[model samples]
Target: MCIAYLLMARKNSFLWLLLLSLICTLEYIVYMGAKPAGDFSASAIHIDMLQQVFGSSRASISLVRSYKRSFNGFVAKLTEEEMQQMKGMDGVVSIFPNEKKQLHTRGVLDSGIWPESDSFDDEGFGPPPSKWIGTCQGFSNFTCNNKIIGAKYYRSSGQFRQEDFQSPRDSEGHGTHTASTAAGGLVSMASLMGFGLGTARGGVPSARIAVYKICWSDGCFGADILAAFDDAIADGIQLPLELFHGNEKTDTNISFCCNDGPVLASITNFSPWSLSVAASTIDRDFFTKVQLGDSNVFEGVSINTFELNDMYPLIYGGDARILQQVLVEQI
Candidate 1:
């Protein structure tokens, strides 16, 4: 699957992912007509349609999630034959394979944040911006501070692993890293193994973070992502700059940065009113030295800052798995 990580400076980032139709076992997004009105909920209508198309037994097994709040749609695992049948079905707008996108280390307003992380400390922060109007919806073991102004989670499938947190608390570090990188607070002497030593900070350290947890262990689902976009827009957060082509300057408030690796058409995060950023080369690099027990030394490019003073056994990647299994058995 392709996962895109976005970083917005002082404002909300507007990113768009292009979906491609391909033959695979991957899940597909089944878009439908506008949400149904009246007492019949959109989710119920979607289920009913699925039952009619695939019958009750098959629909129950194939249906993954239903989109109700923002639009009318559902995600499911469908075969080519089933997809064809769905196309001919009434109320179905379009169906496309949930294509994969590459993920950037920088995160969008996604995942859940680790509120206890040092990067999210609110020691010197003031109240949220005057225009801020968001709320915290953490269920358990999750809280928001001035720095992380808001939090929310979505799981349309109503399924989660035993390890998954039911709240906006990050069990995996990905969300915390991305959230901090976008607008994290200042952290002094922060380094991994004493590397990259400095006061670690984000692009806009003063900006508040509002998280929308849409990803989980099964990977990010298309339905959840769309739901996040819907809520983010409703929360008065400015997103996506729909620009065709121009040399004109954009607004001073919204800043944009993205990689040029992907084709321009594939990336829809363009705006005539926002300045688009281009990548630049770093001024310096860090090198690491590895000293073997045999008194031989090897040098490589790395950000390692920790000083090694003792000799230790080196293990190969393949052997590490066996070692882990042995350790687990012992425990």
Candidate 2:
């Protein structure tokens, strides 16, 4: 009887382990499918400046016509009739009103002034993964851990100041690039039918963008970076924790930084809504030699890659076609 009972117990344990493995595999598949294959970082849109440069014809028409304007104040709110009219115009695909919410901005600071060697706590913020708490340069240690989020630097007022909440704008183009990559207007493949097939679009083009000029022109910051994150969290968008994995030999030589492990934990503990993303480049040489290393752990998260240039054109140019392809392929 004892022997029979032992055999039965072993059989049950094996069955349970098999079930768990199956469940994990299914969950991974679902996660991979849901992940977007594009970037969704923030970008700056100086409507006023753009309007001045391009004039009201294309600028105003696109903003008003596209219904993509979302700043403090400017043109009077459009009425339902006006909205209808704009939607009916040529080349018009869809228009969405910008809703006010807490805004999140990201940027890099001047590494020379701020120094990547500075500690994290000194900069007045904990790493994304609170567990990795200690001290390290600004928040780059933490920021680098999660490539999805940009780095933070120490700011001492001036153009990068967070007090005014307006003006200066993101001149560096980093913020604007990020925003466009996240969500920009989609371009039609019909325009490219003859040029072979090239579909490029943002991860979430419909999402409204609010740029907070926080980083320096060269990229560096401190409080402003935290403010941006705080604002984003308060704005009600989900924020994902950062995850870091560092090699002891490599990381030791580095000054400020957090590993993916800590960032992921922080995202899980702090923000509940935002999802985390890991950067994956398509360059076989660069990715293989530097980024990928020996670890295949990041395969679980959604991955998106773009050329070093502005991701907006690609996103705005081919969003619709990509969506269509995805749907058709799924079907």
lDDT of each: 0.68, 0.33
For residues 90-152, what per-residue lDDT tens digits would candidate 2 score against the true structure? 333344443311222322211211112111112222334433222222332222222122332
- Taking all chains together, the TM-score of candidate 1 against the true structure is 0.62
What's the TM-score of every candidate structure? 0.62, 0.26
Q: For residues 1-331, could you state the per-residue lDDT of candidate 1 as single tens digits?
A: 2222111221342212111111223577888745567555666666777677646655555667776644568887665656778888887878978653333342554568889988888988888887777779956577888888888887876789988898888777778888887888889999777666789898898877888887776666666777676677667677542221222354343344554545655443445555655456767677878899787989988775456778878889799999999999999
Which one is best on TM-score?
1
What is candidate 1's CA lDDT for residue 222?
61
Best by lDDT: 1
- Candidate 2 runs further than 4 Å off: 1-156, 159-168, 188-197, 240-278, 283-331
Scored against the true structure, residue 56 in model 2 reaches a CA lDDT of: 42
* Model 1 lDDT-worst window of ten: 14-23
